[model samples]
Target: MDIVSHLNDRLLFAVPKKGRLYQQCVDLLKGADIKFNRSNRLDIALCTNLPIALVFLPAADIPRFVGEGRVSLGITGQDQVAEAGISVDEVCNLGFGSCKLQVEVPDQGQFTDPRQLIGKSIVTSFTNLATDYFRKLEAEETNGVGADEQTQSSKPLKTTIKYVGGSVEASCALGIADAVVDLVESGETMRAAGLKAIATIFETSAVLIASQHPTHKDLLELIVNRIKGVIAAGKYVLCNYNCPRSKLDSVLKITPGRRAPTISPLEEDDWVAVSSMVEKKRIAEVMDQLRNKGAEDILVFSISNCRV
Candidate 1:
């Protein structure tokens, strides 16, 4: 804090400019009560409530910005950190934008696993990440990178890299690259591209990255902590239902919250109103479960903020 604030630089943060991840960054900021007016240029958005300017860049470029100290903080995918080979520590993981990095080849290809890729060429936007994964896997027999595995890596990462801008999966049978390294949500696109995932590199999700040399660490972390709280509180609904004393334990299992349920005696001496939170996605199922357990008069409500 002392070192960062003494530098007297305007804090800069980078965000995914445009993509599925861009909207998520915006929603997360807003949920944290961070306000900004578009003013004139939409690309260079500002946070009106804090001493910060948020520059929206391609999601892939965020790690570089933070690494170069051009920006002090960034919201980006974890995959970007490895791809950029940057000097930034992942300070926090913001729980949205989850995806996986995987290797895919034509569904009918002879390749069944990574070992089959020994003499093959691969195309990917993420060359560094793929190289690291394979290099490490090849190290298993030696306990870790010893002389033999070093020779294997030096023998030319047989997997060639092509700078295909998009649709790396479709390049397989099309013959641009032998295999493709790309992000997968459900593997539906890989199948549609006539490919199947042969190996999983890593599970990727959105994260907050910070430079090793930040000029405003306090302000940078204050914003990050608030955004994390917002993410923690998302996707839950507060619910209350009345149930007979005999069925109280069953209803509790259906709608458990951060703490024990709040209970109150109802006008009917044998009944009590039980209040708790049910996850938004599980509401329907929980209600049915509660009803089957003798819960009556169920009420669901939304919560705007929850710190814990």
Candidate 2:
């Protein structure tokens, strides 16, 4: 199809080639009905069903590409966006791959607060966020000092931030750093490495981001809406049931949907059919509640994709 030659005409969608979010991002695109094929040796794939090109790059590099307008859209971690310090518009939160960027010290260490690590050496991949956090703490400490004392001090001690591409947790044991700022999902890795989180710098999840100025705004919006629909489908389920007309008000209370429940007539007089979308996690309890409220023939359906 001469994909490379026609790339300029298609919207570029940067995706994580491999990492924690890679598989999930692939699943999201599939859910959105984006069809594509790649040789795997190639980093780019052209969607057969849409005028889009998926550029698989490192998750951390996505924000830079999208922010610089080199790509029209991307799915990457919120922490990556913050660390990149780029000016991309966050289209929507994908609500998966949730984690926290945190400050962690050795478990046996006396440091229990991020403030205690000021002026100490910290190793991290996220050099910018870590440096900014400690600098803010340093500024606060300086603000508390008397004006005369501040004048006498040579300068506020600067926190030493070292950039490590990986294995930040080993820095403390190796005597190279006092602590580390890293992403923690389950804390198992930190615990195994004899570390404990003192403070969370920020909680983050996968986010859909767009260039500040996209070449194809309409196409970008269409893909964004489709991805949002997939996210909504993952979090919710469609619930349908029949109930007495007199009990409709009560059933509505049990399943009060995102907006409102859909009601339909039934063959039996004084009876009605109801349909609503309920949170997937609470579907069990919702069904039980409806059954107790004189609802009958209850059913639940999984939503593959939805607009809302």
Candidate 3:
């Protein structure tokens, strides 16, 4: 598991050490056929099959490392990238670990809109994003677009934003802030704490970020393409079937591949073979339609990975 002998010339890839995103990132790498041994208590690991060395770090810290060129690439939440306020090329959306950064207030409070809590105190782990949100509100107020213009015209709302490490939802109940901004995977946690979301600051999911100063452009592009291939492969399946020549056109419409369905001549001159890629989720419905349209010998098989 040392892998150090092959690590010196590899591109550094940072991923979350422990969190909701850690295992998902590992799965994505494996799906792309990047092999590595993740030994316990190891901060760094080498991808034996690729020119990449993975650095395990906090998800929140991934953005900074990539931005500073300390790591050539990383995977982290879009919200974290915004919070870090760094410049990095977003390669692609991984489409997992979806969540929302929201503004929540106590259930019994009189708050009905974001404008209602203008001058009130808010607490959150995302202090910078919270402050930036307030600044935008102030600018909107100056342009006469904010509600309660007359009251807010004289001076911008001096909203107080406090930073907390964790349990931001408890801040309101403990009188630390009038409202709290935090990540919400489900409304259950907020409901349990007697709080409700008043506004969603931003939506987020895991995304691949690449350094602007990449030293290994070719390797980076290869990994990115492999990941894209894995993601596309998961969403689709291969559908192969035979259809009478007269019904070939109709059946082809039912299972069109990325470009077009593959058609081949059959031993029976009046029949033809058709093969196409269909979405896995809609395979049942697609099969039914093809059968009704005179398709025969239909078969659907899973694809481990594909380029298109």
lDDT comparison, 2 vs 3, better candidate: 2
| lDDT of prediction 3 | 0.88
- The full ranking of all candidates by lDDT, starting with the best, is 2, 3, 1
| Steric clash pairs (candidate 3) | none
Clashing pairs in 2: none
Per-residue lDDT of candidate 3, residues 129-210 (tens digit)? 9987776676575565554645544564478888998888899999989899999997888999999998999999999999
Candidate with top TM-score is: 2
Ranked by TM-score from best down, the candidates are 2, 3, 1
lDDT (10s digit) by residue, model 1, range 25-98: 98887888878765454556556777777778899989988999668888999888878888898988887789
lDDT of 2 by residue, 1-308 (tens): 56689799899999999979999999999999999997758999999999999999999999999988669999999999999999999989999989999999999989998888887899999988887677667766767533443343346448899999988889999999999999999999899999999999989999999999897888888998899899999999999999989999888999999999999999999989999999999999999999999999999999988996
Highest-scoring model, lDDT:
2
lDDT of 2 at 93: 95
Report the candidate with higher lDDT, 1 versus 3.
3
At residue 29, candidate 1 shows an lDDT of 79
Worst 10 residues of 1 by lDDT: 1-10
